[model samples]
Structure formats: structure tokens, C-alpha cells
Target: MRKLFRRQGEQRKIRDKSDLIVKSNGQRNSELEKGINFYAEYLKHLDACSSGASQLSPSDEAHTQNSDLYDGKATFATTQSELLQKLEDAYQRESNLEEKLKEKIKSYQELKEENVSLNKQIESFTTGQTKLAEKHSRDKRALVEEIVELQRRLDGLTPSLALKEAQIARLETEKDTANNQVRNVTNQLQCLQMKLDEARRDEAVISKLDLERRDEMDSLRNSLKRFEIEIEDYKEKERTFAEDLSDLKRALREAELLGKKEKAIAEKALEENSGLIKENSELCAKISLLEIEIAQLNKDNEFRKMNDINLAELAEIRESEKRSKLEVSRLQEKLKAEQERLHNTEAQFDEYRKKEEEVGQWHHRTQKELEGLQTLSSSLSNENKLLRQDKLTLSDRCEELQNKLRKKDEEFERMRDEYETVSEHYRKVLEKLELETALQHERAGEYEDLVNRVHQLSASLSRDDSSSKSSRGKRQTASSENSSGKSTGEEKVQFIVLNLADLPVR
Candidate 1:
């Protein structure tokens, strides 16, 4: 009994420990689930921010146009610098998140290891319970066998003393019935134990699924992190492109203004060149008239040399030709200057065309870049959509698993209740068996006393016969009375056996 009680106490302690472990595991699981949910939500928020940035990117062009060129450039420079700083900050944040994720992974690994250990402990505890149950069953069987043997001995000893064999047979039948009840109860207990083991196995499977889900979540998070980094890189490129576009637009505008000024300067130079050409033609005609007049005067002089004319007129004509030659020289120099100015204007115009071509090329390149960025943004959005779908599917699976786990828990609780009730019934049966054994011992003791009294009466009757043998009649009378008393004693012994046998087994 003391051993049984001690075993019960140990079993209770083990049960309590198991319960504590289970509760702790449950709390840890809940905490892990909460952490996972938090990370999931955070990832969703990041995706939203990325999508919003993509949506707002086109509007930046309109905003850029509204601002003054120089002011926009300055602001763009500052914003680009700030973006660089923010990118750096983002990198730092990503590193921190990675470190945190690593720590979380480590903690999760530790939890997994702890869960495994706990599962092993649970298994060991279950094995111990099974062993204890087997030992109890063995003890009960041994006790039952001992009771059967004791009853057999009582049956043999009391066979000739009274008509009590039928009562003993009935007691033996009752013992057999109790034994069968114990066997049936034990069978039921075993079945319950099997169910409990299966429940535990299911729990282990659920834990495994949880771990797999966590691993998948980690992978998804890593992928999302990579996508975020790529998105940030793309955003930086877009900002740089936008800045370049703004600068190109500014330069193009300045080039256009310069080209217009040069065109006007070229047109004025062309008009001056036309006027200089007409003046040069008029001066050449005047020079030609002078040459003809000079030829006429020379002919007249030749004729006058034969018949004498004034030298003064010829000298005056020579001075007039010299002045005309000087005027022609001045006009020719002015015309040369105008032509040089026209050539310079043409060169400026050529340079302006080259610059315009360069602006067109830059515009084309920027457009292509914007188109590429748009395509990249579209792809990223598609990926985000896919990721969101995956998350939703994972969540649904998790919910289903949770529901299954809840059902398993409910079943486990029900099994535990059944086990407890069965154990209580078994304990009651054991107690009743013990009481029955105790009663059997008392009855055996009373039977031994009756046997001793019978032996003593036989011894006294033998002495009386020996002492009164000479008075034969009186001896016969005394013997008959002794026989009657012995018969009465036998009847009393039978009555006691019947009464003991008639007692209910329960």
C-alpha cells in the first residue's frame, strides 16, 4: 500500500511537470506566432509604401516643371543628397533587421530544440506511466492468485467439517468474476493509453508543421528584403535620372535662347554684307568711267603735243583718280570685315545645331530610361501581388492548422478525462480487493479457532471414555450426549461458513 501511494505521488508529480511543460510550450508558440504576425504586417506596410512611391513617381515630373530651373537644380541636389543619406540609413536599418532576424531565428532554433527535449520527456513520462500500470496490474494479478490459493486451502480443510463446499465454490466463482472485471478494465486502460500516445504524436506533427511554416516565413521575409533593396536601388536611379532630365531641360532651354540670338546676329550680318556689295559695285562703275575719261584725255594730250595744250588739266585728272583709288580701298576693307562677321555667325549657328542635336539625344535617352523604370515598377508590383497571394495562402493554411490543433487539444482533454475516470475506477477496485482479502484473512482465522476447538473436544471425549469404561451404560449415555454436542458444534461451524460465503463481494 505504501509503495502504491508513493508511486501515485510520483505519477502525480510527473503529470504536473508535464502539464507545466505543455503550458510553457503553448505560451512560447503563441509568442512566436505573434512575432511572425508582426513581421508579416511590417512587410505588408513596406510593400504599400513601395507601391505608393511608384504611383507618385510620374507626378514628380509635373512638380519639377513648376519650379524654377536653378532653384529646382539646387533642391534636386539637396534631395539627392538626402536620398543618399536615407539610402544609407535604409541600409543600416536593413542590416539591423537582418541581425534581428538572425537572432529571432536563433531563438526559434532554441525553442525547437527545447520542444524536442520536452517531447522526449513526455515520451519518457508516458513510458513510465505504462510501466507503473503494468506493475500495478501484475500486483493485482498476484494478489488475486494468492486469494484463490488461500480459498483452495480453506476448501480442503473444511471439506469434512460441515456442508460448506458449495459456499466455497460460489466464493471462487466470485473471485473469477472480479478477475475478469480487472482484465476488462486493464484492457480499456490500455486502449485509452494508446489514444493518448497517438494524441501526443499528433501534437509533435503539429509542432513540425509550425516549424516548417516558420521556415517558409523566414524565406519569404528574406525575399521581400531583397526586393526592398532592389526597389530602393531603382528609386535612387530614378532620382538621378530625374535630376539629369531637369538639368538637360535647363541646358536645352539655354541652348535654344543662344541659338535664337546667333540667328538674329547672322541675319543682320547678311544684310550688311548685301549693302557693302552694292556700294562696291557702284564705286567700281565710277572707277570704270574715270578710266575711260583718262584714256580720252591721253589721246587729246597726244594730239595737243603735236599742237601744244595745258599740263595742269592732266595733273588735276591724276589727283582725282588717286582719291577714287583711296575710296575703293576703304570700301573693300569694310566689305572684308562684313564677310568675316558673316562667317563667324555661320560657325555659331553650326555650334547651336550641334548642341540642339545633343539635347535631342539626351531627351531620347531620358525617355527610354523613364520607360525602363516604368517597366521595372510594373514588374515589382506584379511580384508584390504574387507575394501577397502567397502570404494569404500561408495564412489560410496556418488557420487550418490551428483549427486542427484545437481539435486535437479537445480530443486530448477528453482522453485525459477518461483516463482519470478509469484510474479512479481502478483504484476503487483495488481498494475493494484489498478489503475482500482482509475479510478472507479474518474468516480463515475464525475457521482455525473452530478447528482447534474441535480438536480439544475430541481429546476431552477420549479422556472421558477412558475414565468411565467400567460403567458401560453410563459411558454409552455420556457418549451419546457428547456426540449430540459435537454435532451441534459442527452445525455452528457450518452456519459461520455459510454466513461468510453469503457476504457480498463488493
Candidate 2:
């Protein structure tokens, strides 16, 4: 148990050391990141400072030279000369520092390689430990196999003991039966004596009794001897059976204990691997985030370049914005025209409704038809939405193009808008022409109804004319009859129209 705790403590120390290494690595990475940032920043500041210093120092040098030109030449030259020397020394110092930083970066790279090597070592060790555990498990399995064999033999012995007990029980029953027979024999003997006393007057009955008693006693003794032999064999088997059973039980217990230990070890190793996997995932995520940050910074630098645009590009972009807007307006007008046409069709549906009622006796069929129409309408509505979405996409594309070309396309957009407006007006006229189609349909329906009425009236007039010729004197003149027929037909049609209030017309 102390050894187990010692191993656990050693493992814990190793875990702690690994944790510390990971933490130190994180700190080092942070320091490296900071160093990179500082290096870049320092370079920026150095460039700015160097430029500023160079510019200012030259001015200072020129000023001193001019002052020396006014003052004593020798004294001014000496002071200017000392100042140049000091500037050169400071510049040399900065250069040396830059070189040192580069060396530090190189050292950081070496440390990174070392860290990778260490990680590889850890992985190999982990694999080695896993192989050991597998070997241990294989050994335990062999032990279990041996234990199983022992159990099977022990199980076989248990049944043998049972069989022996059953045999012993049968032998005991036979012995009891034999003892009863002996008692019966003794009673018979007493009875036989009583009989002999009585049978002394008759000698034949006594002779028969003696033969029967001898045969029964001899059979009872032989049975008892066989039972004794069986008991001895059973006792010997029970002793060996007890020893084998104890051995099998011990082996079974050992196998169970070994299996538990192997499972526990496997669980522990799994936990360690899982922890390592989690750490790796976290590291990968961190690296990805760092890469993303770098990309964002680069993009920002590029974005700043966009601000340096001169005047000409801005004008072109503005102009493109104008032409795209005009095209979008034309498509909007066209969509409006389509929507208006659908509305007019819906209004005409009211007239269809009156006809539907006249045919309303087929109400269920009408309702089913109406459901179909509703479904069609829903489909049309979906199509309309899709068309609208397509229009939106076109508008977005136009806007993006306009934004990109505003500075260069101003004249082009002005001309395009003029053409678009003309096209829009022509498209509206087409919509008006479609609306006129509804009126044409209504007129056609009215003309058909009028023609049908005239036909019916003419048939009635012919029947009246025939009946009059058969019953009365003479036929009327053709022109007068025609005028009379037309007038009467017109009046009858008007009366029919007045009576039928459920007309399908608007």
C-alpha cells in the first residue's frame, strides 16, 4: 500500500511539473508576442524618430554653420564638429540595440524547437506506458483462463459428490430394509419355536422353517457388506472434492481481483490521455486566434490605404450611384404594373362569383374548385415574392457597381437614366393595353348572350308563323313581319333581362 502511494505521489509530481512547464510556455509565448509587437512598434517609432531627427539636425547644422559664418569661424566649427560626433555615437548605440533584439528573436526560435522536441518525448513515453499496460492485461487474461479451468473442474467434482451422496443414501435405505428383515427373521424364529413346541407332535413344519431362516439371514449379511464398501469409497471422494473446491474458489477470487486492477489502470491512462488531448485542443485554438488577429491587423493596414484616394475617383463613384438608382426605379415601376394587373384580375373575380352561385347546386364541387384556385393564388403569391427578391438582388448589384464606379461614370449614368425613364413610360403603356383586354372579354361575353337570345326569339317567331298559316287566313308581308319580329324579340329580351336580376355582368 505504501508502494502504491509512493507511485501515485511520483505521478502527481510529474503532473505538476508538466503543468508548470505548460504555464511557463504560455508565459513565454505571451512574452514573444509582446516582443514581436514591441519590435514592430519600435521600428515604427525608430523610423519616425530617425526621420524627425535627421530633418531637425540638418536644420540645426545649417543654422550653426550660418551662425559661424557671422561669428568667429574657428569656434563655430569646433562646436558643430562636437555636436556631429555626439549624434553619430547615439545612432551607433541604437544600431547595436537593434542587433541585440534580433539575436533575442533567434534565441526564442531555438527555445520553440526545444519545446517541440520535449512534446515528442512526452508522446513517446505515453505510448510506451500504454504498451506496458496492454502486456499486463494479457498476463491477467492468462491467469483468468487458468482460474476458469479450475472452476470447471471444481464444478465437475461438486456433481460427483452429489452422486456419491445419492448412492450413500440408497445404501442407507437398503441397510435399514436389511435390519427390518433381520427383526422379522427373529420374530419368525420365536414364532417358529412356539410353532415347534406345538409342532413337536408334527416334525415336517419345523424342517421347512429352518430352511427359510438360513436363506434370509445370508442374503441380509451380503447386502450389509456391500453398503459398507460403498460408504468407504464415498468418504474418500469427499476429502479430495473438498480440497479441489477450495483451490478453485481461491483461483476464481484471484482472477476477479486481477481484472479489477487492470481495468483501473486502463481508466487512469485514459484520463491522462484525455487531459493531454484537451490541452492540445486549447493550444490549437489559441494559435488560430493569434493567426486571426494577425490577419485583422494586416487588413486594417490595407483599409487605411483606402483613405488616400484623390478627387477624381470620388466623382466617378458618385455618378455610378445615380445611374444604378434610375435602373432600380424602372424595375420598381414594372413590378408595380404586374401587381396592378393582378388586382384587376381579382376585381373581375367578383363577376365569376355570381356565375358560381347560379351553379351553386354543385356547391361541394364549387368549393373544391375554389380550394384549387386558392392554392393557385398561393403559388402565384410565392412566385411574386420570388420575383421581388430577384429584383432586390438586381438592385443590390447595381448599388454595389455604382459605389465602385461613382467617380468615373457620372456622364454615363445621366444618359442611362434618360433611356430608363423612356423605357419605363413605354412599359406603363403596355400595362394599360393589358387592362383593356378585360373590357374586350366582357364585351365578347355580352355579344354571345345577345346572339343566343336572338336565335331563341327567331325560333319562337317561326313556330307562331306556321301555326297562324294553318289556323288563320293569310301570311303578313315579309318586311313588316321582319320589323315586327325584331321589335317583339327586343321587347321580350328586355323583359327577360329585367326579370333576371342575377346577371353575371359587372
Candidate 3:
């Protein structure tokens, strides 16, 4: 029993030390220890006083215990004025606590009003973000429609290009035929040139034959004159030479006939040669015309080749246009993807902002709750302190009353035992109260740690938000630059297309 009492006393002393330390907040441990030691010494003094009083009159203790449970009231009358003064002080402390509570409630109401206004502002921002998102979606839809139309136009243009290619192929075939005709005409001109050379040689031979015929006729005429002279000489011989003269005349006649026949043959040959010359001149003129036609055909072929080059260039231009169109489409797709990512990012940002706002609101609420809980804990601590003081004074009065009963005799012995039992029960209650206060202190520490962690998390999230905003700004600038680049590419494609259009078709 003594050991239990000692343990209880030790526990009470420890509780008092912890309470004093808590009340001091940051005061020195030495002060707390001194306070605890002083309380322990006071408790020991009370115990000594009670022990001395208990031995005074143990015989009348039972009778005193049975007489009146309220008999100690008259004995406590001497301390009435002091008790009234303590009560008045307690009322003042209660009123002060009430005023502080009212002030906290008013501040809580003001915080609630401010939170509502901030929520309204947040709602307006969200609505604006939503509107901008809608506009972006509409723009995306329009771009998609425009792209589809361009694709349709490209599809239409493909068949025209094919038809143009077919026409070019036909033009190439025509050019080949014209080239063959030119080659055939050139071969004919070469053969005609050889024929013209042969004709010139024949004309030279005809002129040489005409000159030999003239010389032979001149020689025959001279021989005839000599025969006539001989005839004349023979006539003088009269009758003897008559037969010879007649023979000579007949020979002269025959020579005359041969000369006439030769003249006719020469005329006929001259006529035939003149006709051949006329025919050759006609062939030369035809050859000249054919040469001119061949030259024209060559010029036409050159033109065709140039047309082919132009067509090839046009086809190349078309290919480049197609490539540009594909690039544009690809860029559009990239833009679409970027827009989608931006949309997703915006959504995530909005969600993060919402979560941050919620966290801020939660932090505020937790702070308020913690403050209220702290105030309640402090009030409870103060009440516990006052209750302990009251209990100490009551215990001192009870010891004095007990001592008086002991002096009254051996009849109060049973009352003393009952009082001890009641005292044991009260000690147990006080120990339980101390344990409860200790649990509250531990809970308060946990709440403080939670608040600190919340603060740290909020700071980290704020940093992340700032970085995201900067990155988003960079992306916007990059997107603008890409748009400018695409516009330039489109301009180049348009210029190429226009140049291709201006090229002449074969």
C-alpha cells in the first residue's frame, strides 16, 4: 500500500512538472524542475500534517463519520471570504475566455466571406478559359475543312495533269513522224543532187558531139567543091568524059542527102537535150523546196523538244507542288497534335489550379481548426490548473477537518478509513485526467507536423506551376515561329505553281 502511494505521488509530481513545462512554453527546464520540486514538497507537508492529525484521536473516528457528511461546512466558514475572492477571479477568467471565443468566431466568419469572393473570381477565370478553348476547337475544325477542300482540288488536278501528259506523248509521236519525213526528204534531195550532176555531164557530152558534127559538115562541103572543079575540067573533054561527069553528079546528090539527114538528127538531139535541161531545172527547184520544208520540220522538232522540256518542267513543278501540299498537310497534322497537347496541358493546368485552390482552402480550414483546438486545449489546461489549486486547498481543509475528528476520539476511526478510500478513488481520477491531457498534447504535436507538411507541399506545387507557365510561353513562341515558316513555304509553293502555269504547252 505504501509503495502504491509512493508511485501515485511520483506520477502526480511528474504530471505537475509536465503541466508547468507546457504552461511555460519555452522557459528553462530548471524552472520547471524547481516548480515540480516545490509542489512535491508541499504535497509531503500535507501528508505529514494529515499523519499527525490521524494519530490524535482514533477511537471516536466512526461516530464522527456517522454524525454528518456535511459537518465540515461549519469548519470551512472561516475561509469563506477567501473562497469568494477566488470565485470572483474565476468568473473574470471565464468572461475573458468568452470574449476571445467570440472574436475568433467573427474572424472565422470574415474568412468565409473572403473565400466565397475568391471562389467567384476563380469561376470567372474558368469560364474565360472554357471560351478560349471553344474558339480554338472551332479554328481547328475550320482548318480541317479547308484541308479537305484542298485535297479535293488536288484530286481534281491529278486527272488534268494526266491528260496533259497524254497530249505531250501524242506531240512527241508527231515530232518523231516529222523528223522521219525530214530525213526522207533529205535523202531524196541527195538523190536529186546526184541526178542533177549526171544531167550536167550529159549536157557537156551533147555540146561536144554538136561541135564534132559541125567540123565534119565543113570538111564534107570542101570535098564536094573539089569534085565540082574536077567535073568542070572533065566537061571540056566533051563526049568522052560525059559518062564520068554524070556519075560524079549522082555522087554529089547522094552526099547532099546524107548531109540533110545529119542536120535532122542534130536538131532532134538538141530538142531532147533542151527538154532534159528543163526537167533537171524543175527537179532542182523541187529539191530546194523540199530542203526548205526539211528546215521547217527541224525548227518544228526543236520547238517540240523545247515543249517537251517545258512539259517536263511543268511535271516537276507539279511534283514539287504535291510535295508542298503534303508538307502543309503534315504541318497541319503537327499543328493539330500540338493544339491537342496544348488543350490537354491547359486542362491539366486548370485541374492543377483547382487542386491548388482546394489545398489552399483546406489549409486555411485546417489552420482555423488547429487554432480552435489549441484554444480549447489551453482553456482545458487553465481549468485543470485552477481545479488542481482548488483540490489542493480542499485537501488542506480536509486534512484539518480530519485532524479535528481525530481529536474528537476513537469513534471517527471508520470515517477516517472511508475518507482514505474516497481519497484513493479521487487520486485514480486525477491520474486518468493527467493521461488524457498527455494524449491531447501528443495529438496537438501531430497536427502541427501535418500543418508543416502541407506548407511544404504547397510551396513545391507553386514552383511547378511557375515552371509550367514559362514552358507554355516558350511553346507559344515556338508555335508562332513555325506558323511564320509555314507561311513562307506556302508562298514559295504558290510562286512555283504560278511559274509552271505561265509555261507554254506543246
TM-score rank, highest first? 1, 3, 2
Give the Å error, residue 68, model 2: 99
Q: Give lDDT: candidate 3, residue 444.
A: 44
The local lDDT score (0 to 100) that residue 17 gets in candidate 1 is: 55
- After superposition on all C-alphas, the RMSD of every candidate to the true structure, in Å, is 54.2, 86.5, 78.0
Shift in Å, residue 450, candidate 2: 99
Worst 10 residues of 1 by lDDT: 459-468
Residue lDDT tens for model 2, 290-360: 45754664464356446665446545544544554454455456545645644554454444445445444
Of 2 and 3, which scores higher on TM-score?
Answer: 3
Quote the positional error of residue 378 for candidate 3 in Å.
1.3
Local accuracy of candidate 1 as per-residue lDDT tens digits, 412-493: 6775676677667657766866765676666556545645555554444344334434344645765565445544544555
Local error of candidate 2 at 476, Å?
Answer: 99
Q: Between candidates 1 and 2, which one is better according to TM-score?
A: 1
lDDT of each: 0.61, 0.52, 0.53
